[model samples]
Target: MTRMRIEGLLAAFPKLIGTGKQHTYVETENVRYVYQPMEALYLLLITNKQSNILEDLDTLRILSKLVPEYSYYFEESICKCAFDLILISLGHKENVTVAQVKQYCEMESHEEKLHRQMREDKIREAKDEMKRKANEIDKNKAIHVIYRL
Candidate 1:
Protein backbone atom coordinates (compact mmCIF):
# COMPACT_ATOMS: atom_id res chain seq x y z
CA MET A 1 0.00 0.00 0.00
CA THR A 2 1.03 3.59 -0.54
CA ARG A 3 2.32 5.80 2.28
CA MET A 4 -0.62 8.17 1.87
CA ARG A 5 -3.15 5.37 2.26
CA ILE A 6 -1.41 4.04 5.35
CA GLU A 7 -1.24 7.53 6.77
CA GLY A 8 -4.94 8.05 6.05
CA LEU A 9 -5.78 4.82 7.85
CA LEU A 10 -3.60 5.77 10.82
CA ALA A 11 -5.16 9.23 10.93
CA ALA A 12 -8.64 7.71 10.85
CA PHE A 13 -7.78 4.89 13.25
CA PRO A 14 -8.35 6.78 16.48
CA LYS A 15 -11.87 7.67 15.43
CA LEU A 16 -12.62 4.28 13.81
CA ILE A 17 -11.62 2.21 16.85
CA GLY A 18 -13.80 1.86 19.92
CA THR A 19 -12.76 2.73 23.49
CA GLY A 20 -13.63 -0.77 24.69
CA LYS A 21 -11.02 -3.57 25.02
CA GLN A 22 -13.09 -6.16 23.10
CA HIS A 23 -11.90 -5.26 19.60
CA THR A 24 -8.56 -6.63 18.36
CA TYR A 25 -8.85 -5.63 14.70
CA VAL A 26 -10.35 -2.88 12.56
CA GLU A 27 -11.15 -3.51 8.93
CA THR A 28 -11.38 -0.95 6.17
CA GLU A 29 -12.44 -1.17 2.55
CA ASN A 30 -9.06 -2.44 1.29
CA VAL A 31 -6.91 -2.96 4.38
CA ARG A 32 -6.94 -4.69 7.75
CA TYR A 33 -5.37 -3.25 10.87
CA VAL A 34 -4.61 -6.06 13.31
CA TYR A 35 -3.52 -4.37 16.47
CA GLN A 36 -2.74 -5.17 20.11
CA PRO A 37 -3.09 -2.33 22.56
CA MET A 38 -0.18 -2.09 24.94
CA GLU A 39 0.02 0.46 27.77
CA ALA A 40 0.38 3.90 26.15
CA LEU A 41 1.20 2.31 22.77
CA TYR A 42 -0.35 0.10 20.12
CA LEU A 43 1.38 -2.77 18.36
CA LEU A 44 -0.21 -2.54 14.90
CA LEU A 45 0.06 -4.72 11.82
CA ILE A 46 -1.43 -3.34 8.64
CA THR A 47 -2.07 -5.79 5.79
CA ASN A 48 -4.16 -5.92 2.64
CA LYS A 49 -7.72 -7.24 2.96
CA GLN A 50 -6.87 -10.28 0.80
CA SER A 51 -4.19 -11.39 3.29
CA ASN A 52 -4.80 -14.05 5.95
CA ILE A 53 -6.07 -12.60 9.23
CA LEU A 54 -4.70 -15.49 11.31
CA GLU A 55 -1.16 -15.07 9.99
CA ASP A 56 -1.27 -11.30 10.46
CA LEU A 57 -2.42 -11.75 14.04
CA ASP A 58 0.33 -14.32 14.62
CA THR A 59 2.93 -11.83 13.35
CA LEU A 60 1.48 -9.14 15.60
CA ARG A 61 1.70 -11.58 18.51
CA ILE A 62 5.36 -12.24 17.82
CA LEU A 63 6.06 -8.51 17.48
CA SER A 64 4.15 -7.74 20.68
CA LYS A 65 6.28 -10.23 22.60
CA LEU A 66 9.51 -9.07 20.98
CA VAL A 67 8.80 -5.35 21.48
CA PRO A 68 8.42 -5.59 25.23
CA GLU A 69 11.54 -7.75 25.44
CA TYR A 70 13.58 -5.06 23.67
CA SER A 71 11.84 -2.03 25.09
CA TYR A 72 10.76 -2.30 28.69
CA TYR A 73 9.30 1.13 29.40
CA PHE A 74 7.22 1.30 26.20
CA GLU A 75 8.01 4.96 25.67
CA GLU A 76 9.67 7.07 22.97
CA SER A 77 12.98 5.63 24.14
CA ILE A 78 12.04 2.45 22.29
CA CYS A 79 12.65 4.22 19.00
CA LYS A 80 16.27 4.80 19.92
CA CYS A 81 16.86 1.08 20.44
CA ALA A 82 14.93 0.03 17.33
CA PHE A 83 18.09 -0.75 15.33
CA ASP A 84 19.51 -2.86 18.14
CA LEU A 85 16.18 -4.68 18.38
CA ILE A 86 16.26 -5.41 14.66
CA LEU A 87 19.86 -6.59 14.88
CA ILE A 88 19.11 -8.87 17.81
CA SER A 89 16.04 -10.27 16.07
CA LEU A 90 17.84 -11.02 12.81
CA GLY A 91 21.20 -12.04 14.34
CA HIS A 92 19.83 -14.92 16.40
CA LYS A 93 18.51 -18.32 15.30
CA GLU A 94 17.31 -19.67 18.67
CA ASN A 95 16.73 -17.89 21.96
CA VAL A 96 19.06 -14.89 22.08
CA THR A 97 21.24 -13.75 24.97
CA VAL A 98 22.79 -10.33 25.61
CA ALA A 99 26.27 -11.79 25.44
CA GLN A 100 25.53 -13.46 22.12
CA VAL A 101 24.23 -10.23 20.66
CA LYS A 102 27.32 -8.38 21.85
CA GLN A 103 29.57 -11.08 20.46
CA TYR A 104 27.78 -11.01 17.12
CA CYS A 105 28.28 -7.25 16.81
CA GLU A 106 31.92 -7.34 17.92
CA MET A 107 33.11 -10.38 15.95
CA GLU A 108 34.35 -9.99 12.38
CA SER A 109 33.21 -12.33 9.60
CA HIS A 110 35.80 -14.57 7.88
CA GLU A 111 35.48 -12.66 4.61
CA GLU A 112 36.00 -9.32 6.35
CA LYS A 113 39.12 -10.63 8.14
CA LEU A 114 40.49 -11.99 4.87
CA HIS A 115 39.94 -8.65 3.12
CA ARG A 116 41.66 -6.76 5.95
CA GLN A 117 44.63 -9.13 5.83
CA MET A 118 44.91 -8.77 2.06
CA ARG A 119 44.86 -4.96 2.34
CA GLU A 120 47.60 -5.06 4.99
CA ASP A 121 49.71 -7.37 2.82
CA LYS A 122 49.37 -5.02 -0.16
CA ILE A 123 50.41 -2.01 1.96
CA ARG A 124 53.43 -3.94 3.31
CA GLU A 125 54.41 -4.99 -0.19
CA ALA A 126 54.16 -1.38 -1.43
CA LYS A 127 56.39 -0.17 1.42
CA ASP A 128 58.92 -2.94 0.73
CA GLU A 129 58.99 -2.03 -2.99
CA MET A 130 59.60 1.66 -2.14
CA LYS A 131 62.48 0.66 0.17
CA ARG A 132 63.98 -1.59 -2.50
CA LYS A 133 63.80 1.20 -5.13
CA ALA A 134 65.40 3.68 -2.68
CA ASN A 135 68.26 1.22 -2.02
CA GLU A 136 68.81 0.71 -5.79
CA ILE A 137 68.92 4.49 -6.34
CA ASP A 138 71.48 4.87 -3.51
CA LYS A 139 73.68 2.08 -5.01
CA ASN A 140 73.52 3.74 -8.48
CA LYS A 141 74.42 7.12 -6.96
CA ALA A 142 77.40 5.51 -5.09
CA ILE A 143 78.59 3.81 -8.33
CA HIS A 144 78.28 7.13 -10.23
CA VAL A 145 80.36 8.93 -7.52
CA ILE A 146 83.09 6.17 -7.69
CA TYR A 147 83.13 6.42 -11.48
CA ARG A 148 83.52 10.20 -11.27
CA LEU A 149 86.62 9.71 -8.95
Candidate 2:
Protein backbone atom coordinates (compact mmCIF):
# COMPACT_ATOMS: atom_id res chain seq x y z
CA MET A 1 0.00 0.00 0.00
CA THR A 2 2.87 2.35 0.74
CA ARG A 3 4.55 1.56 -2.54
CA MET A 4 1.21 2.09 -4.28
CA ARG A 5 0.99 5.57 -2.82
CA ILE A 6 4.51 6.36 -3.92
CA GLU A 7 3.78 5.10 -7.38
CA GLY A 8 0.65 7.19 -7.58
CA LEU A 9 2.64 10.25 -6.61
CA LEU A 10 5.26 9.57 -9.26
CA ALA A 11 2.62 8.95 -11.90
CA ALA A 12 0.92 12.25 -11.17
CA PHE A 13 4.16 14.17 -10.90
CA PRO A 14 4.59 15.02 -14.55
CA LYS A 15 1.17 16.61 -14.71
CA LEU A 16 2.07 18.53 -11.58
CA ILE A 17 5.41 19.55 -13.03
CA GLY A 18 6.48 22.89 -14.57
CA THR A 19 5.32 26.42 -13.99
CA GLY A 20 6.87 27.00 -10.56
CA LYS A 21 6.33 23.39 -9.51
CA GLN A 22 9.66 21.83 -8.63
CA HIS A 23 11.05 19.09 -6.42
CA THR A 24 11.57 15.32 -6.26
CA TYR A 25 14.88 15.76 -8.05
CA VAL A 26 18.05 17.72 -7.42
CA GLU A 27 21.69 17.41 -8.29
CA THR A 28 25.01 18.85 -7.19
CA GLU A 29 27.84 17.44 -9.24
CA ASN A 30 28.89 14.28 -7.37
CA VAL A 31 26.12 14.82 -4.82
CA ARG A 32 22.41 14.35 -5.23
CA TYR A 33 19.29 14.41 -3.10
CA VAL A 34 15.74 13.36 -3.64
CA TYR A 35 13.22 15.15 -1.47
CA GLN A 36 11.43 12.01 -0.38
CA PRO A 37 10.33 12.12 3.21
CA MET A 38 8.00 9.20 2.67
CA GLU A 39 9.30 7.16 5.55
CA ALA A 40 9.37 10.15 7.87
CA LEU A 41 5.88 11.25 6.96
CA TYR A 42 4.61 7.67 6.97
CA LEU A 43 5.60 7.38 10.60
CA LEU A 44 3.72 10.52 11.43
CA LEU A 45 0.63 9.40 9.50
CA ILE A 46 0.39 5.82 10.77
CA THR A 47 -0.32 6.26 14.46
CA ASN A 48 0.01 2.55 15.02
CA LYS A 49 3.32 2.39 13.23
CA GLN A 50 6.32 3.05 15.43
CA SER A 51 9.35 4.93 14.23
CA ASN A 52 11.45 7.90 15.25
CA ILE A 53 9.50 10.45 13.23
CA LEU A 54 9.88 13.18 15.77
CA GLU A 55 13.64 12.98 15.69
CA ASP A 56 13.74 12.61 11.94
CA LEU A 57 11.30 15.42 11.37
CA ASP A 58 13.27 17.64 13.71
CA THR A 59 16.31 17.12 11.52
CA LEU A 60 14.26 17.90 8.44
CA ARG A 61 12.77 21.00 9.99
CA ILE A 62 16.21 22.21 10.85
CA LEU A 63 17.53 21.40 7.43
CA SER A 64 14.58 23.07 5.77
CA LYS A 65 14.88 26.17 7.89
CA LEU A 66 18.51 26.56 6.93
CA VAL A 67 17.96 26.05 3.21
CA PRO A 68 17.46 29.72 2.55
CA GLU A 69 21.10 30.30 3.32
CA TYR A 70 22.07 28.22 0.30
CA SER A 71 19.71 29.93 -2.07
CA TYR A 72 22.49 30.32 -4.61
CA TYR A 73 23.24 26.62 -4.50
CA PHE A 74 19.66 25.39 -4.17
CA GLU A 75 16.27 26.01 -5.60
CA GLU A 76 13.78 27.19 -3.02
CA SER A 77 10.84 26.00 -5.09
CA ILE A 78 12.12 22.46 -5.19
CA CYS A 79 12.79 22.47 -1.48
CA LYS A 80 9.34 23.84 -0.76
CA CYS A 81 7.78 21.31 -3.11
CA ALA A 82 9.33 18.44 -1.23
CA PHE A 83 8.31 19.81 2.15
CA ASP A 84 4.82 20.34 0.84
CA LEU A 85 4.75 16.74 -0.32
CA ILE A 86 5.81 15.54 3.09
CA LEU A 87 3.17 17.62 4.85
CA ILE A 88 0.42 16.73 2.40
CA SER A 89 1.24 13.05 2.61
CA LEU A 90 0.87 13.15 6.36
CA GLY A 91 -2.22 15.33 6.23
CA HIS A 92 -3.91 12.71 4.05
CA LYS A 93 -3.71 10.27 6.91
CA GLU A 94 -5.98 10.67 9.91
CA ASN A 95 -3.52 9.00 12.26
CA VAL A 96 -1.26 12.03 12.46
CA THR A 97 -0.72 13.58 15.88
CA VAL A 98 0.28 17.13 16.67
CA ALA A 99 2.68 15.87 19.28
CA GLN A 100 4.39 13.55 16.85
CA VAL A 101 4.81 16.25 14.28
CA LYS A 102 5.97 18.78 16.83
CA GLN A 103 8.42 16.44 18.43
CA TYR A 104 9.81 15.42 15.08
CA CYS A 105 10.10 18.98 13.91
CA GLU A 106 11.33 20.10 17.32
CA MET A 107 8.65 22.75 17.30
CA GLU A 108 6.41 23.96 20.04
CA SER A 109 2.85 22.67 20.33
CA HIS A 110 1.54 25.93 18.96
CA GLU A 111 3.85 25.67 15.97
CA GLU A 112 2.82 22.10 15.33
CA LYS A 113 -0.84 23.00 15.50
CA LEU A 114 -0.22 25.88 13.20
CA HIS A 115 1.53 23.63 10.72
CA ARG A 116 -1.40 21.23 10.74
CA GLN A 117 -3.82 24.08 10.28
CA MET A 118 -1.71 25.44 7.44
CA ARG A 119 -1.99 22.10 5.66
CA GLU A 120 -5.77 22.31 5.84
CA ASP A 121 -5.64 25.84 4.50
CA LYS A 122 -3.38 24.75 1.66
CA ILE A 123 -5.83 22.02 0.69
CA ARG A 124 -8.64 24.52 0.57
CA GLU A 125 -6.50 26.91 -1.44
CA ALA A 126 -5.59 24.23 -3.92
CA LYS A 127 -9.25 23.36 -4.43
CA ASP A 128 -10.12 26.97 -4.99
CA GLU A 129 -7.24 27.35 -7.44
CA MET A 130 -8.33 24.33 -9.46
CA LYS A 131 -11.92 25.47 -9.53
CA ARG A 132 -10.90 28.91 -10.73
CA LYS A 133 -8.73 27.47 -13.49
CA ALA A 134 -11.50 25.13 -14.60
CA ASN A 135 -13.97 27.99 -14.74
CA GLU A 136 -11.55 29.99 -16.83
CA ILE A 137 -11.11 27.14 -19.26
CA ASP A 138 -14.85 26.67 -19.57
CA LYS A 139 -15.34 30.38 -20.09
CA ASN A 140 -12.75 30.41 -22.85
CA LYS A 141 -14.37 27.44 -24.55
CA ALA A 142 -17.71 29.14 -24.41
CA ILE A 143 -16.32 32.24 -26.04
CA HIS A 144 -14.76 30.18 -28.82
CA VAL A 145 -18.03 28.41 -29.49
CA ILE A 146 -19.97 31.65 -29.51
CA TYR A 147 -17.58 33.11 -32.09
CA ARG A 148 -18.83 30.57 -34.64
CA LEU A 149 -22.42 31.68 -34.20
Candidate 3:
Protein backbone atom coordinates (compact mmCIF):
# COMPACT_ATOMS: atom_id res chain seq x y z
CA MET A 1 0.00 0.00 0.00
CA THR A 2 1.00 3.64 -0.27
CA ARG A 3 3.09 5.23 2.49
CA MET A 4 0.43 7.77 3.39
CA ARG A 5 -2.26 5.13 3.68
CA ILE A 6 -0.01 2.93 5.80
CA GLU A 7 0.79 5.91 8.01
CA GLY A 8 -2.91 6.75 8.30
CA LEU A 9 -3.70 3.23 9.36
CA LEU A 10 -0.84 3.18 11.85
CA ALA A 11 -1.94 6.54 13.24
CA ALA A 12 -5.40 5.09 13.88
CA PHE A 13 -4.03 1.81 15.26
CA PRO A 14 -3.84 2.79 18.90
CA LYS A 15 -7.57 3.48 19.00
CA LEU A 16 -8.33 0.25 17.19
CA ILE A 17 -5.96 -1.76 19.39
CA GLY A 18 -7.79 -0.86 22.63
CA THR A 19 -6.55 -1.61 26.13
CA GLY A 20 -6.26 -4.73 28.32
CA LYS A 21 -5.35 -8.09 26.68
CA GLN A 22 -4.23 -7.36 23.13
CA HIS A 23 -5.11 -9.52 20.15
CA THR A 24 -2.47 -11.18 18.02
CA TYR A 25 -3.87 -9.59 14.89
CA VAL A 26 -6.37 -6.94 13.78
CA GLU A 27 -8.03 -6.96 10.40
CA THR A 28 -9.29 -4.16 8.21
CA GLU A 29 -10.98 -4.39 4.81
CA ASN A 30 -7.69 -4.55 2.85
CA VAL A 31 -4.93 -5.04 5.42
CA ARG A 32 -4.02 -6.87 8.57
CA TYR A 33 -1.94 -5.60 11.48
CA VAL A 34 -0.04 -8.38 13.19
CA TYR A 35 1.57 -7.03 16.31
CA GLN A 36 3.44 -8.25 19.37
CA PRO A 37 3.49 -6.02 22.40
CA MET A 38 6.96 -5.55 23.86
CA GLU A 39 6.82 -3.91 27.26
CA ALA A 40 5.72 -0.33 26.43
CA LEU A 41 6.35 -0.76 22.71
CA TYR A 42 4.79 -2.71 19.86
CA LEU A 43 6.38 -4.67 17.00
CA LEU A 44 3.90 -4.32 14.13
CA LEU A 45 3.63 -5.90 10.71
CA ILE A 46 1.32 -4.57 8.06
CA THR A 47 0.29 -6.95 5.29
CA ASN A 48 -2.40 -7.23 2.63
CA LYS A 49 -5.47 -9.34 3.25
CA GLN A 50 -4.38 -11.83 0.58
CA SER A 51 -1.12 -12.52 2.41
CA ASN A 52 -0.79 -15.60 4.61
CA ILE A 53 -1.72 -14.81 8.19
CA LEU A 54 0.42 -17.63 9.54
CA GLU A 55 3.52 -16.38 7.77
CA ASP A 56 2.89 -12.83 8.93
CA LEU A 57 2.61 -14.03 12.48
CA ASP A 58 5.83 -15.96 12.11
CA THR A 59 7.59 -12.87 10.80
CA LEU A 60 6.26 -10.84 13.71
CA ARG A 61 7.48 -13.56 16.06
CA ILE A 62 10.96 -13.41 14.61
CA LEU A 63 11.00 -9.62 14.69
CA SER A 64 9.77 -9.59 18.28
CA LYS A 65 12.64 -11.88 19.19
CA LEU A 66 15.22 -9.88 17.27
CA VAL A 67 14.10 -6.46 18.58
CA PRO A 68 15.27 -7.17 22.10
CA GLU A 69 18.60 -8.51 20.85
CA TYR A 70 19.29 -5.35 18.87
CA SER A 71 17.86 -2.74 21.23
CA TYR A 72 17.60 -2.45 24.97
CA TYR A 73 16.48 1.16 25.42
CA PHE A 74 13.96 1.33 22.56
CA GLU A 75 15.24 4.74 21.49
CA GLU A 76 15.24 6.45 18.11
CA SER A 77 18.20 4.30 17.02
CA ILE A 78 15.86 1.33 16.95
CA CYS A 79 14.51 2.67 13.64
CA LYS A 80 17.85 1.94 11.93
CA CYS A 81 17.98 -1.51 13.49
CA ALA A 82 14.44 -2.10 12.22
CA PHE A 83 15.55 -1.19 8.70
CA ASP A 84 18.38 -3.69 8.88
CA LEU A 85 16.03 -6.30 10.29
CA ILE A 86 13.60 -5.76 7.44
CA LEU A 87 16.38 -6.11 4.91
CA ILE A 88 17.53 -9.35 6.47
CA SER A 89 13.98 -10.64 6.81
CA LEU A 90 13.28 -10.01 3.10
CA GLY A 91 16.58 -11.66 2.13
CA HIS A 92 17.91 -8.39 0.79
CA LYS A 93 20.75 -8.71 3.33
CA GLU A 94 22.33 -11.84 4.72
CA ASN A 95 24.18 -12.84 7.89
CA VAL A 96 23.89 -9.35 9.37
CA THR A 97 24.50 -8.44 12.99
CA VAL A 98 23.74 -5.48 15.25
CA ALA A 99 27.39 -4.48 15.16
CA GLN A 100 27.31 -4.49 11.37
CA VAL A 101 24.23 -2.27 11.36
CA LYS A 102 25.98 0.11 13.76
CA GLN A 103 28.97 0.23 11.41
CA TYR A 104 26.73 0.97 8.48
CA CYS A 105 24.97 3.77 10.38
CA GLU A 106 28.35 5.21 11.37
CA MET A 107 29.53 5.15 7.75
CA GLU A 108 26.38 6.95 6.61
CA SER A 109 26.82 9.53 9.39
CA HIS A 110 30.45 10.09 8.38
CA GLU A 111 29.47 10.64 4.76
CA GLU A 112 26.80 13.13 5.82
CA LYS A 113 29.33 15.00 7.97
CA LEU A 114 31.73 15.26 5.00
CA HIS A 115 28.95 16.59 2.77
CA ARG A 116 27.94 19.15 5.42
CA GLN A 117 31.54 20.34 5.72
CA MET A 118 31.82 20.72 1.95
CA ARG A 119 28.63 22.77 1.86
CA GLU A 120 29.94 25.04 4.63
CA ASP A 121 33.18 25.55 2.75
CA LYS A 122 31.28 26.52 -0.41
CA ILE A 123 29.15 29.01 1.53
CA ARG A 124 32.21 30.53 3.13
CA GLU A 125 33.88 30.90 -0.30
CA ALA A 126 30.76 32.59 -1.72
CA LYS A 127 30.64 35.03 1.23
CA ASP A 128 34.35 35.87 0.74
CA GLU A 129 33.79 36.56 -2.98
CA MET A 130 30.82 38.83 -2.17
CA LYS A 131 32.91 40.79 0.35
CA ARG A 132 35.73 41.23 -2.18
CA LYS A 133 33.29 42.52 -4.82
CA ALA A 134 31.76 44.98 -2.30
CA ASN A 135 35.20 46.29 -1.36
CA GLU A 136 36.13 46.75 -5.07
CA ILE A 137 32.88 48.66 -5.65
CA ASP A 138 33.61 50.96 -2.70
CA LYS A 139 37.17 51.68 -4.02
CA ASN A 140 35.84 52.50 -7.54
CA LYS A 141 33.16 54.83 -6.05
CA ALA A 142 35.83 56.66 -3.99
CA ILE A 143 38.08 57.06 -7.09
CA HIS A 144 35.16 58.43 -9.14
CA VAL A 145 34.19 60.92 -6.37
CA ILE A 146 37.81 62.17 -6.11
CA TYR A 147 38.04 62.70 -9.93
CA ARG A 148 34.65 64.49 -10.05
CA LEU A 149 35.71 66.82 -7.19
Candidate 4:
Protein backbone atom coordinates (compact mmCIF):
# COMPACT_ATOMS: atom_id res chain seq x y z
CA MET A 1 0.00 0.00 0.00
CA THR A 2 2.78 2.43 0.87
CA ARG A 3 4.77 1.55 -2.24
CA MET A 4 1.72 2.09 -4.42
CA ARG A 5 1.00 5.40 -2.77
CA ILE A 6 4.58 6.54 -3.38
CA GLU A 7 4.51 5.38 -6.97
CA GLY A 8 1.25 7.22 -7.53
CA LEU A 9 2.85 10.41 -6.25
CA LEU A 10 5.93 9.90 -8.40
CA ALA A 11 3.80 9.28 -11.48
CA ALA A 12 2.94 12.96 -11.71
CA PHE A 13 6.53 14.01 -12.29
CA PRO A 14 6.64 12.91 -15.92
CA LYS A 15 3.59 14.98 -16.74
CA LEU A 16 5.15 18.01 -15.12
CA ILE A 17 8.38 17.43 -17.01
CA GLY A 18 6.43 17.00 -20.24
CA THR A 19 5.00 20.47 -19.84
CA GLY A 20 8.35 21.92 -21.02
CA LYS A 21 8.66 24.16 -17.98
CA GLN A 22 10.73 23.92 -14.86
CA HIS A 23 8.46 22.31 -12.32
CA THR A 24 9.04 22.19 -8.60
CA TYR A 25 5.79 20.62 -7.51
CA VAL A 26 2.67 18.70 -8.43
CA GLU A 27 -0.55 18.44 -6.43
CA THR A 28 -2.76 15.39 -6.36
CA GLU A 29 -6.10 14.89 -4.64
CA ASN A 30 -4.51 13.66 -1.42
CA VAL A 31 -0.92 14.85 -1.49
CA ARG A 32 1.56 17.31 -2.94
CA TYR A 33 5.06 16.46 -4.15
CA VAL A 34 7.64 19.24 -3.91
CA TYR A 35 10.84 18.40 -5.75
CA GLN A 36 14.32 19.85 -6.16
CA PRO A 37 16.50 18.79 -9.04
CA MET A 38 20.11 18.19 -8.14
CA GLU A 39 23.18 17.55 -10.28
CA ALA A 40 22.70 13.78 -10.23
CA LEU A 41 19.49 13.32 -8.29
CA TYR A 42 16.09 14.70 -7.37
CA LEU A 43 14.85 15.27 -3.84
CA LEU A 44 11.13 14.93 -3.41
CA LEU A 45 8.89 15.64 -0.46
CA ILE A 46 5.34 14.34 -0.19
CA THR A 47 2.99 16.29 2.02
CA ASN A 48 -0.72 16.79 2.58
CA LYS A 49 -2.24 18.68 -0.32
CA GLN A 50 -3.63 21.37 1.98
CA SER A 51 -0.18 22.33 3.33
CA ASN A 52 1.31 25.75 2.70
CA ILE A 53 3.09 25.77 -0.65
CA LEU A 54 5.28 28.74 0.20
CA GLU A 55 6.61 27.08 3.30
CA ASP A 56 7.19 23.88 1.36
CA LEU A 57 9.15 25.80 -1.26
CA ASP A 58 11.15 27.47 1.47
CA THR A 59 11.92 24.09 3.01
CA LEU A 60 13.03 22.72 -0.36
CA ARG A 61 15.36 25.68 -0.77
CA ILE A 62 16.83 25.19 2.68
CA LEU A 63 17.31 21.46 2.14
CA SER A 64 19.00 22.08 -1.17
CA LYS A 65 21.43 24.49 0.48
CA LEU A 66 22.04 22.22 3.48
CA VAL A 67 22.58 18.94 1.61
CA PRO A 68 25.80 20.07 -0.03
CA GLU A 69 27.22 21.19 3.30
CA TYR A 70 26.69 17.75 4.86
CA SER A 71 28.05 15.43 2.15
CA TYR A 72 29.83 17.67 -0.38
CA TYR A 73 28.39 15.21 -2.87
CA PHE A 74 25.03 13.47 -3.16
CA GLU A 75 25.09 9.98 -1.57
CA GLU A 76 23.87 7.86 1.34
CA SER A 77 26.02 9.87 3.78
CA ILE A 78 23.81 12.88 3.13
CA CYS A 79 20.79 10.88 4.30
CA LYS A 80 22.49 10.08 7.61
CA CYS A 81 23.05 13.74 8.46
CA ALA A 82 19.88 15.21 6.94
CA PHE A 83 17.73 14.64 10.02
CA ASP A 84 20.08 16.55 12.29
CA LEU A 85 20.00 19.59 10.04
CA ILE A 86 16.24 19.33 9.57
CA LEU A 87 15.52 19.17 13.31
CA ILE A 88 17.72 22.21 13.72
CA SER A 89 15.90 23.96 10.92
CA LEU A 90 12.45 23.37 12.39
CA GLY A 91 13.30 25.04 15.74
CA HIS A 92 10.05 26.01 17.56
CA LYS A 93 8.07 27.08 14.54
CA GLU A 94 5.22 25.19 12.92
CA ASN A 95 6.09 26.79 9.58
CA VAL A 96 9.79 27.36 9.03
CA THR A 97 11.31 29.88 6.68
CA VAL A 98 14.70 29.63 4.98
CA ALA A 99 16.19 32.41 7.08
CA GLN A 100 15.09 30.73 10.30
CA VAL A 101 16.49 27.42 9.12
CA LYS A 102 19.81 29.06 8.26
CA GLN A 103 19.99 30.85 11.60
CA TYR A 104 19.14 27.68 13.50
CA CYS A 105 21.67 25.63 11.59
CA GLU A 106 24.32 28.16 12.58
CA MET A 107 23.42 29.21 16.15
CA GLU A 108 21.26 26.32 17.49
CA SER A 109 19.36 28.56 19.93
CA HIS A 110 16.61 25.96 20.12
CA GLU A 111 18.69 23.57 22.16
CA GLU A 112 19.60 26.37 24.56
CA LYS A 113 15.94 27.28 25.01
CA LEU A 114 15.03 23.63 25.58
CA HIS A 115 17.76 23.24 28.18
CA ARG A 116 16.64 26.41 29.96
CA GLN A 117 13.03 25.23 30.03
CA MET A 118 14.05 21.85 31.46
CA ARG A 119 16.11 23.58 34.14
CA GLU A 120 13.18 25.80 35.11
CA ASP A 121 10.83 22.81 35.32
CA LYS A 122 13.27 20.91 37.52
CA ILE A 123 13.60 23.89 39.84
CA ARG A 124 9.84 24.25 40.07
CA GLU A 125 9.46 20.53 40.86
CA ALA A 126 12.12 20.76 43.52
CA LYS A 127 10.38 23.71 45.17
CA ASP A 128 7.07 21.83 45.20
CA GLU A 129 8.69 18.77 46.76
CA MET A 130 10.40 20.90 49.42
CA LYS A 131 7.10 22.56 50.33
CA ARG A 132 5.40 19.18 50.63
CA LYS A 133 8.16 17.92 52.90
CA ALA A 134 8.00 21.04 55.06
CA ASN A 135 4.22 20.66 55.40
CA GLU A 136 4.65 17.04 56.45
CA ILE A 137 7.19 18.08 59.10
CA ASP A 138 4.85 20.75 60.41
CA LYS A 139 1.97 18.22 60.63
CA ASN A 140 4.18 15.77 62.59
CA LYS A 141 5.31 18.56 64.99
CA ALA A 142 1.69 19.66 65.60
CA ILE A 143 0.62 16.05 66.36
CA HIS A 144 3.50 15.60 68.84
CA VAL A 145 2.70 18.86 70.65
CA ILE A 146 -0.98 17.91 70.97
CA TYR A 147 -0.02 14.50 72.44
CA ARG A 148 2.29 16.22 74.98
CA LEU A 149 -0.50 18.59 76.07
Question: Over the full model, what C-alpha lDDT does candidate 4 score relative to the true structure?
Answer: 0.72
lDDT of 4 at 19: 40
Model 3 vs. true fold: TM: 0.53
Candidate 1 residue-wise lDDT, 1-149, digit = tens: 57797688878877777887687999988778889888876777776788777766766766676666667666666655543334324423345445565566578999999999999999999999999999999999999999999
Reference-based TM-score of each model: 0.52, 0.29, 0.53, 0.47
Poorly placed runs, candidate 3 (over 4 Å): 75-84, 87-149
For model 4, residues 1-149, the per-residue Cα lDDT tens digits are: 38787687677765655344577887767878888877746777677887788877877877787776657656666555544343533433266655766676678577799999999999999999999999999999999999999
Give me the overall lDDT of model 1: 0.74
Stretches of candidate 1 off by over 4 Å are 79-149
Indicate the worst ten consecutive residues by lDDT in candidate 3: 84-93
Clashing pairs in model 2? 54-104, 58-104
TM-score of 2: 0.29
Candidate 2 at 136: error in angstroms?
A: 0.5
Candidate 3 residue lDDT tens string, 1-149: 57798689889778778677657888888788888888777788877787787777766766676667668677565755644444434622245445665565456567788999999999999999999999999999999999999
Alpha-carbon error at 123 in model 1, in Å? 20
lDDT of 3: 0.74
